[model samples]
Target chain A: MRDSCSRELTCIARSDPRIIILSGDIGNHMFDGFKAEFPDRFYNCGVAEANMISVAAGLALSGYRPFVYTFAAFDLTRCYEQVRIDVCFQNLPVVIIGLGGGLTYAPLGPTHYICEDISILRCLPNMTIVCPADQAEVMASLRSSLDHHGPMYIRINKKNEPCIYTGEPDFSLGRAQLIQDGNDVCIITTGVLLSEVIRAARILEERNISACVVHFHTIKPVDEIMLREVFSRFSVVVSVEEHTLPGGLGGMIAEWMIDNRIKSSDLIRIGTGDYFLTHCLSQKEARDHFGISADLIAGKIADGLNK
Target chain B: MALAAKISGNKYRSFVLMSDGECNEGTVWEAVLLAPVQKLGNLIFIVDNNGWQATGRCDDIMHLNPLADKFKTFGWNSFEVDGHNFEELLNIFHSIPVDSEKPTAIIAHTVKGKGVSFMEGDNNWHYRIPTADDVTRAKAELGLE
Candidate 1:
């Protein structure tokens, strides 16, 4: 996803002279191609994420589209106030690219693990949060960012994420993409976890339970139209994400259900528990530990349906 | 922004007014290191060195004395001036980019509250809003009466 973002950003920079890339001393080699082409457009703001965000905000204020990129944990946590006040409060056109969303950097420990980005960023006004499912969605999101008006947070995995879409699937901000149609259950997932959810849906299908697969690339300003449709149509709606249960896809859909006074469907949220990982684990191991693996997700969905 | 202007061929200059207390933040130094590397001559940072922070004196709390020297050491075109003097400020503002390839950092020395006899140099003024009577007395002190 990061590779796709870099390549797409370079492609965008070719046509749009206003495109600028700012990094927090990370991904120097990853962005080598971009720097080689437009040396003047790329800025390595050193290890200071706060100043990088403010600098991006300053550039955006000057009519330049600046994308601030860094590890998701550092990008959002270390410089949260700057992201909130300088970027979101001012409603600037700065695309904050958070690499290593969720536990992609789990082996690097909790310092690099980010599961609260969506929760915190969602509460900020004028902030649009998009967690791309795969490389194609990453490119599409970057292209859509060019036309977006305010602050945007693009949470992405590091690299080599499983491709959810064969090609770009008519992507747009705040719109949900339906991967497959069913009636018994609707699995609404976001980020790189879409692959696991799809696999889980197939498992449910084999069990004679028709499961719908819906991909929510954009988390904030969530697909309300789809939420209404899915909740009304399907008796069981499951939300899966690589993030924690609170303030992620599940928490968001739960709130939507309550606010809209829709009690027709039983909503089950599948995410990491409200605790940090104590032992060192890989991304896959962490998912399995949290019961977010495909087989586990299918079992949870079946349990929800039986109840 | 200064870098943006330079790259876009815009002659517009970007000015940032900062407080001496704010210098304690790491972000300030991050930008301080960046502007010089980019040689953003179009950027100007004016620090209001009033010596007082929210709770205590700036030097007593953080020791940010010789602020101009700090910027100078950081590869900026540093200058010191009286913040209250409009003529000095205008002159310094007009003579920006003393070095064409360096960013400018102006350390403007000032009192916490100027022109008001009772309020001047009082850190309490940082949070204290003047009452009706205090306002009248302040006006008299500044000859606004």
Candidate 2:
């Protein structure tokens, strides 16, 4: 994701000289290409998230679109006040790329866990949140965020996940993609978990229960119109995410359902329960333990319909 | 001021910042120094330090003790005045021959949330958007009727 961001930035800078890249001592192996391509435009702020964010705001005021990249926790929460006042209050076009989304740094321990990044960032006004499902989605998201106005937070995973899309798909800011169509259930997924939703759909197919998969890359400014269209067809909706339930994809979907006065649908949210992860575990193992895996999702749907 | 700017070409320019503690980053500090060095005599630096920094007390971070003394050392004409007194602020503003002289610094001592009950002199009020009820009581107390 970091490499992809760097490449996208390089392309943007070639056309727009005002594009600046600011890093907080991270992205060494990633941003070398950007530095080589545009030395004057890239800056290494050196482990100071606060200074980096403020500098980006200042650069924006000077008529430059700055992209600040760092770890998810520091990039969003550490300099939150700076982001709120310096960037968002001024409504600058600063793309904050947060690497290591959710529990991607599992073995690295709780200090690196960014479960609350989405919730904390959601409270800020005029800040768009983008969670790309895979490399393909992230590439499209990077382009979309750069083109969009105002502040944006793009949360990406550290490790390289499989490419979700074979052919290049057109990406819009607030649109949700329907990966699969089902009459019985619609499974909404965000981030890398969308890959799991595909697996879950296949598992449910064997049980004769069709589960539709909707990949919601953009969380804020949600596509209520698209959701209403999908909700019209399916009776039971299951939302999946790698982060905590509250303020994640599930909570957003549920809120949209309530706000639009659309009721009588059994909404099942599959995500990390309100507890900190104990030990280092792979993404698959963590999801299974938390009952957010494909088979578990299939089982939960069967039980919900039976009851 | 224009003569000094002409000598340096177009590397930098200066603007008078009517600012408070809300903006205290290095760029702002750099801006403060640039005015005098660039001979931007029209530059006026006002620090409305209501004795508040976000999180906790300002002194805990680093004692900006004798804040006025720092500006004097920076070769700017400095003044300390009571911020709430409209006449005093106006008098100080009138006193500065800013058109000909060097840059000026006005350190105004005042409360954080001025002229309000429950919020005045509080650091927490810096970021807290007043609730509707609080706004009502405040307007009423200030005789907004």
Candidate 3:
């Protein structure tokens, strides 16, 4: 995902001279190609995420489309206040890239694990949140977000996750993708969890249960039109993501359903329950423990529907 | 600083007005440190070093003593001025440092609640809202007829 971002950003910078990239002193040589070519445009902000965000806002307001990049831990938690006041409140066109989103940094312990960035950023007005499902979606999202005239948060896993989409998606800002059609149940997924949810859908298929797999890459300003269609088509709804239960894709969908008066017999949300993970586990291990893995999701959904 | 460079160059410069407590934030240091790297000659930071923070003295809150020297070390051309002296402020702002390699920091040494006799140097005034009588006394002291 980080590679996709770098590739797309370099592509964008080639055409648009106003595009600038700022980092919080991480990503040692990930941007070597970009730096060698556009030295003036790339700035290493040296572990000061808050300052980098403010400076990005300042740069954005000055007719430059500034993208602030950093570890997910610092990007969301450390510079949240700066993002809220300087970037979001001002409604500037600053692209915030939070790499290693969710449990991707699980090896580094819970300190680096980010599960609530989506919920935290959603509270800020004029904020666009995009958690791409795969590499293709990442490039498409970066292209779409470049022209978006407001603040955008792109949550991406670090490297080598499952690719859910084969080709470049149409990738509008606030749209959802229907991966499969079904009648028994609907499975909605966000971020890297789309891989798990897709597998879960296939598992349900073998059991004579038709499960619809929908990819909700753009969680904020969600594709309500698509969501409405899904609610009417399926009886039991399940939303999954490698994030927390509250203030995430599942939480937003639940709120929207209640507000729109769409009632489902059963609504299941598969995510990290509201608790801090203390153990130092690998990404796969953490997800498996938290019931966010493909097998766990399949079993949970199958059991719920059979009940 | 980049904003200043992009929009109007040296013609329309930018200024940041911050309090002494703001110096405690790592963001301020980061920004100050980066300004030189960009060589933002049109940017200036006016630090209101009033010697007091919310609960205690500025010394107790953070290690911001000799603020000018700290800014200088961080690549900014630093200056100290009596904040109450309007002429001194005007003179300093009128001239940029000959060392045009970086941005400038003006540490304005000020008394808290300036011109308010009772509130001057009193830490309580930081949080206390001035009452009607206090306002009247303040106005009378300043002869705001």
| Lowest lDDT 10-residue stretch of candidate 3 chain A | A23-32
lDDT of 1 by residue, A250-284 (tens): 88888888899987778888898899987779999
Candidate 1 deviant stretches above 4 angstroms: B1-145
> How many pairs of residues collide in each model?
0, 0, 0
Report lDDT (Cα) of residue A267, candidate 1: 83
Interface residue Cα RMSD of candidate 2 after superposition: 9.7
Q: Candidate 1, clashing residue pairs?
A: none
Q: Each model's TM-score?
A: 0.69, 0.67, 0.69
Please compute DockQ, using alpha carbons, for every candidate against the native two-chain complex.
0.02, 0.02, 0.03
Residue B23, model 2: Cα distance from true site in angstroms: 22
All candidates in order of TM-score, best leading:
3, 1, 2
Which prediction has more favorable DockQ, 1 or 3? 3
